[model samples]
Target: MQLLLVFQGRKLRITVILGAHNVRDREQSQQRIHVRQWVIHPKYSCEGFKNDIVLLKVGINTSPPAHLPKPLNLFLVPSGAECEVAGWGRTSLTGNGSNVMREVELKVQKEKICQQLFKNYQPQSMICVGDDYRKKGVYKGDSGGPLICNQKAHGIASHVPYGYVYPEVFTRISYFKPWIREQLRKFSLQDLPGSPFSD
Candidate 1:
């Protein structure tokens, strides 16, 4: 199956690794895929942080064969739902980034909470996720990671307020499902025979 990936616009990197557990280990099943193209949201902005998402196309070449994870369909994530976020980011307020991948369980906060916390919070496009006690949350270098809930990617880590605050903002995946579908359809056609963009 062909894999089309999505992530936060600002997190576009040179490459992505699949089946990676430890950041420092060169696992036998791990595959490094170079980023080939990035389709940023038309309305995305650095200041307001609205529509802070991007579609990614990657070039895959691996020895011993490698396959990407199954793409999860977007779905509505309920408030107070349990979810997980993983990344190789800092574990503490004063610690450096970790060499091993770490994951933290968080709860999806209500839109009312986000609206109260952030001036630019958009209920239709953003999700509030973190622990109520401000204990569990994504740290630096965790931006653009997936907020997985119910076996699907319900959101993309958008931004965290200064001082590592609780209830971080995330780009709601369900709200952009139409735009994502359209982009995938458009890109699929671009790879068709006789298309100038086709390889």
Candidate 2:
């Protein structure tokens, strides 16, 4: 799969490279899509790892082959909720990444537990999920994927330590719903002011 980024009415391709191990044939499995636009949270910070979420405006050139979860509108995911996470990330802690996307079920951990585990964890902006007992969770290469619960996007996979023992961190969608709506509104206004596709 590929991520599309449209800037100033020009389409830019962002390749999504997956490992070859999980695929039957790597060359034939590659895919691409055209994205109309994308907006990252204004308060996002790479240094402190805060507010790690982005909203993508996909174009109508092609529709997703499979059903996609819609964004959760002002919905708060409760602790212990079983959520599904899918990605082409590493299968094991010591293994190379996977070529085919894999999906796994994880339970959302309490905010207090996450804060205790991660010193820099921001409770208001983040959520944690994993199977600590089995050491199973999101690892390297899984960043920016969605955390789906109840057929809605509740979080975005954000961070995890080197080892897979700790719970994976995710950007809480509920906390930033207003910001996301605002950005989408701004984009709509800019594009609809006259010729919708005008540069």
Candidate 3:
């Protein structure tokens, strides 16, 4: 098993690990596929956290792919739906990240809650999640993680306002389903020789 280290910025490096339980563990079953390329959404806005999804092209591998939850369920996710968010991020305000992957259960908040919290809240593109009273949520290092509801990935952890005390915002996957499909189709056709989509 190999670990592919990809640099996001001059100071930020990311290691995409597959089939691994512990971040520090070098288990024989774990495999790290090298990322060949990545594409960010053209309409992404940093200020408002709109269209904040990225597609990555990785090298082909023999490891069986993990079962991904189907996108676009054709039904709306009701408010207060219990969901889970997992990450290797810090557990506390001043604590360091854990070595093992961890997850926390949070409920989806109503659109009005986010509207009251954020000036730029866009319900069409974002999902608000967390337990405000309990002060439980995705912390500093949990950004870009998935908000899994009923086994489907509904959101991507986007930002937390003023800290984790308030609800965290996520990029709604369902809202951008068309964009995701278009990107995947483009990437799939890129490998053909002399194709216009070729990298």
Those runs of model 1 whose alpha carbons end farther than 4 Å from true positions after fitting are 1-13, 60-75, 132-134
- Please rank every candidate by lDDT, starting with the best: 1, 3, 2
Best-matching candidate per lDDT: 1
Residue ranges of candidate 3 with Cα displaced over 4 Å: 1-15, 61-75, 194-199
The worst-scoring run of ten residues by lDDT in candidate 3 lies at: 1-10
Supply the TM-score for candidate 1: 0.82
Q: In terms of lDDT, which candidate is stronger, 1 or 2?
A: 1
Candidate 2: Cα lDDT at 139? 79
Instruction: Give the best candidate by TM-score.
Output: 3
Overall lDDT per candidate, in order of appearance: 0.78, 0.72, 0.77
Give lDDT tens digits, candidate 1, residues 98-159: 98888889998878888887888997888888865848788788889888887777788888
Candidate 3 local lDDT, 47-141, one digit each (tens):
87778888766666556533343455523667889999999888888899878888889988888889988899998788888866766788878
Cα-lDDT of candidate 3 = 0.77
lDDT of 2 by residue, 1-199 (tens): 2455665699678543333335556565454444556777777777547988877665442434322333453336778899998887888778888877788888988777777767788877788788677557787878888898888777889988555545888987778767877986776775675856433
**Model 1 lowest lDDT segment of ten:** 65-74
Q: Clash number for every model? A: 0, 0, 0
Better of 2 and 3 by lDDT: 3
